[model samples]
Target: MGALDIFCYTLWILGSVTAFPFGDTLNRQAVLKTNIQTTAQFPNNTWLENIAVRANGQLLVTTIVPDAAVYQVDPTQSHEPLLVAKFPSALACFGIVELGLDEFIVTTNNWTLSTAASPPGSNSAWKIDMTTFSESSGQGAVITKVADISTATYLNGMTVLDKTAGTVLMGDATLGVIFYLDTYSGEYEVVLDDVLMKITVPGPVKLGINGVRLLGDELYFTNNNQGLFVKVPIEKDGTAKGPYEIVARFDTILDDFAFDTTGNSYVTTDPDNTVDFVTQKGSVTTVLGNKNSTLVAGATSAAFGRTFEDEGILYIPTNGGLAGPVNGTFIEGGKVMAFDTSVVA
Candidate 1:
């Protein structure tokens, strides 16, 4: 068989042998009494990967499968989503982060889902300027290619390390390293590499150090293979200042996460169809969805609403288990889900 066929065969073998555990083994319940609601829904097979909230309270969602594009969704109104931009050459758009007031940075990849493979020199980054963008006016934002990071494989999640310096850190899942990129000059380098960031599982499905974020001087990341959410002290330039510390552990894999004002994190468990709440002190609980709940099924990434009216609500974008469906059978169209955090237990 050919290379693509061989790769597909390998994935099929892994899928048959691997046992991805679901459910709350710790008996964790809803930490917050969340009023979950579907804010926006995409077509079936749309793999919504990551999310970022615009200053005006709209959410920018990145789609990896079916189409490699960025969509703008206004949570206040359940209307149709507005197309922000599309990457025709790439097969998927993976991560997004707000760099400036209304400007954002995004990562795109040329990987195929069926074959589970990506061609070399197919990874790149872009900038989307939405300062003067308006949904009704039909005015499109300025799209710019910032850097071509072909050296790093599978750039999944991103977080701004130093906004003033225009520096951002992107997690390279396959390479088990973080690429430090300067958005202005398009210069990039491998900033952080450690065993903690390496993948423990053998297959291509489970990734290592998939989600990354920076708060103050601490760097936080999640490894899907190891099922670990960890944090470490880091410099402004993306260098680790201290050793990595384990924040929490999970049986299922983690995709991406968003931090609230109070330092709590709402993380997405892809196959488990759940959004986990991780407190600053490392308290882990299932605050929304579960192995059976469709509210946030196939949840991939999350972000909190920017406006004061919805600041307490955590906005989650789900793939509806596009890659790994709930119970290995249930799947739905990718959609944006909102969990009101103000309604506490």
Candidate 2:
């Protein structure tokens, strides 16, 4: 909350996380891995909003409504899901990001963004420490509320940044702004905001900036309702260095995205029921989904695999089938899906 230099924490690049070389090598094939009806966990009104991949090949999925459960899916195992932790049926779960080896930060909604006894719909972020998490021991991730973020309008997507101190950058889907969170002090600061982030086409889903990621000094985010993807370079202190750059515009609802070693972006188109393979050149290509009932619709988030069994693979989770069908109506439970890049490689 003070000067950026006072809180600036060193940004760590774990493994090859931010080391990719952007290009054609990322425009690979996308194959459907699984849908909710076919999955072993979450077969109800669980809206799997976001996902984070464990280096061991397991995935942590955060749900949206009905049931606030975090299920762990292991492809290397029998593919059966393990219960990591379930939140109160009242609280809301949205997007998640890996903080460290077994630590993570999760974005939430429903509560007022104030510290007083207000109402729901106000958003916030949380920290899940899994250093000692173990299901066999009847123990799991230790969850804690990140202080001071009660003022967030609609905390949606998140990206970790040590901008002077331990922090995570969060995007408010409704406010069209990104806030820098001080993980240690519990304070936050709005680091970026622009007209491009405001929901110009307020529709049934008027979300502004849905997903965000930082590569070097560049910040990438989705203007959901506007169907636009944008990026901008920021100074070391988290100030914008230049104007917003248009990455691409799509015909469908662009929800969230993930980056691969080639710097190619894999984006999910919500109601369109598809994922787009976006190259660094700002070209859009369909890699998964078909707007059908089977593949995966309502895709709210994406992340690349971190384990050997899943490395280079793009992992995705859906908002069940609650987002409405393009041609008809149906009930789809929250589920996890993935794309195997080996065939394209």
Candidate 3:
């Protein structure tokens, strides 16, 4: 079959699956009532790819299109995005995580969504230190290039595996592998390579293993093309402590997710424009948004608020239906949404 035919066939198969995990009777079509508020909005074509929250509750948002830039958004105040810093020679910025006190690490690449391949030696990591930046003083932040990931393609989600050891795990969706980077030494190596990380079907969207996170002794991730949320016990050294387990599976594309204190995972469905709440026991519920809803539309990545005032808030950044338009026609400017998860029913 041709590529378009295969893509259409994949969608049909995905849409046909309706059984819930472990055969629970809960309706998959149920959408929970959520309290959502738009915190910030950018230009119509802006693609907000990833998000990270500073200790003081400001948001660090990244974009991949138009420019590989990072902006600092204060959710509590005017919500105007302050230009933090832009990366040089990078078309997009992907995963970002806090490395240390007010310091962060971000992944940069020259890859475009229209093309399947990125230029060799264009994948790299950089550090953003927000230590001296005071909003009152109008001081700027510092940006430094950490290391180049010449060996991989399409580095997506990231999480700090060991902070003191300066080791961060990054998922390469194109390569179907995970790389462990040592921030202190600027060295990186492939630490995990499994067949489950690869895309199951050959089509236009070939993304696999989109999101990666570490909670306690287990590492959780999402396989976008396969539509699976998986987890595996891991050591601090980035090695698996046991076999990987499939937490849940769905009929839609999966993106980045955030965990709550009670071990519930709020996973984003990029094309479906919804957030699935996956409990520790593996049951899934569509807790926020839907395929036709503009609320958290094109939600790409999410992070819970850091400060106590907004700790129960799930902050999501969207590409504004750039990936897949809601109801196949609705598209808007990229935005940041604050969902009050504590008030969700």
Candidate 4:
């Protein structure tokens, strides 16, 4: 038989038996999709910019508003109230990563410290302990400043290397450099200096190497304004040991991404409100998202579910609402969405 025949025959036979992980008994149609729904909206956000699923299955998200705060979502309760970890007026957080035990490392740009005469406020990173956090109190959480990038051009995303040693790394969007911080000393250093990370402003779009992910022996990051996907092999200490290589290029402008066990990337296309899949073999395809759908407006970043039940699922967060290709299809303010990946071909 041919490839198409094999696919059709299989769909006609066992599609019903394998529907649990993919769907409920809503309808009687064959399991044509990997899941019954392409994406499910999780109602949490005011201007969410990034998302990371903790080992404990809590959904942690970051916001972009001046009154910015971090939030936690409980997957078990469908209508659970958002748990907010409020930040002071001077600090607004962007990127966040889990550091175990309800603790997280977050990146910040203190816009309040910016002066009308000099460069923008010096950037910094922090460790937020949500252990005894109370959304009502909104101010007593234990917070520590990790990296003080007083001279940093612009700081965006971050990743943790050694939670025990308090080692964290951040990407500079404006100066094109990578800096690692010693959480213990609260000091940071320029560890990687490469032209490949140089910032770009094409017409009106301003972005650079925004988000970085450390794979087994390599690092992958998104260069937005340049529309290039870059990857570099690194040493055990996180220093680049090889020149940056272009894995893929697109005109859509990529944002943050998460990799599956198969090494496939679930990447976000900023204003497009779309998530594109970069397969393990280097092919690119769109998974769930439409220019006109509020389903995933201004899609910013994605992370896979860590629970045994949700292992391969993808959770995407948006930068609120924006205009799509359609005449009136605009995205509403921020949201967190879960997309069924088994649906992907």
Candidate number achieving the greatest TM-score relative to the actual structure: 3
| Alpha-carbon lDDT, every model | 0.81, 0.68, 0.82, 0.64
lDDT of 1 by residue, 1-345 (tens): 345543532332122211122222333576545487889988888888899987667899999888789999989874579989999989999999988878999999887778655566888999999987878964669999999997987898899877788999999987888999999999999989988789766765556889998766777898888888888778878898887777777877888887765566778998788888876566678888778777788888988776657767888898888777777788899999888877643
Residue 308 in model 4: lDDT: 63
As for model 1, its CA RMSD to the true structure in angstroms is 11.1
Q: Which ranges in model 4 have alpha carbons more than 4 Å from their true place? A: 1-45, 79-81, 111-119, 133-141, 322-329
Model 4 C-alpha lDDT per residue in residues 153-244, reported as the tens digit of each score:
66776776666777767788777778887777887788877766775555644567778876666677887777666777777566888777
What TM-score should be assigned to candidate 1?
A: 0.89
lDDT of 1 at 17: 14
How big is the positional error of residue 197 in model 3, measured in Å on the Cα after superposition? 0.9
Q: Which residue runs does candidate 1 get wrong by more than 4 Å?
A: 1-27, 30-34, 202-205
Which of 3 and 4 is ahead in TM-score? 3
- The local lDDT score (0 to 100) that residue 263 gets in candidate 2 is 65
* TM-score against native, each model: 0.89, 0.83, 0.90, 0.80
What's the residue-level lDDT of 250 in candidate 1? 82
RMSD in Å for model 2: 7.1
Residue 68 lDDT (model 3) = 91
Single out the weakest 10-residue window by summed lDDT for candidate 1.
12-21
RMSD of each: 11.1, 7.1, 10.0, 10.4
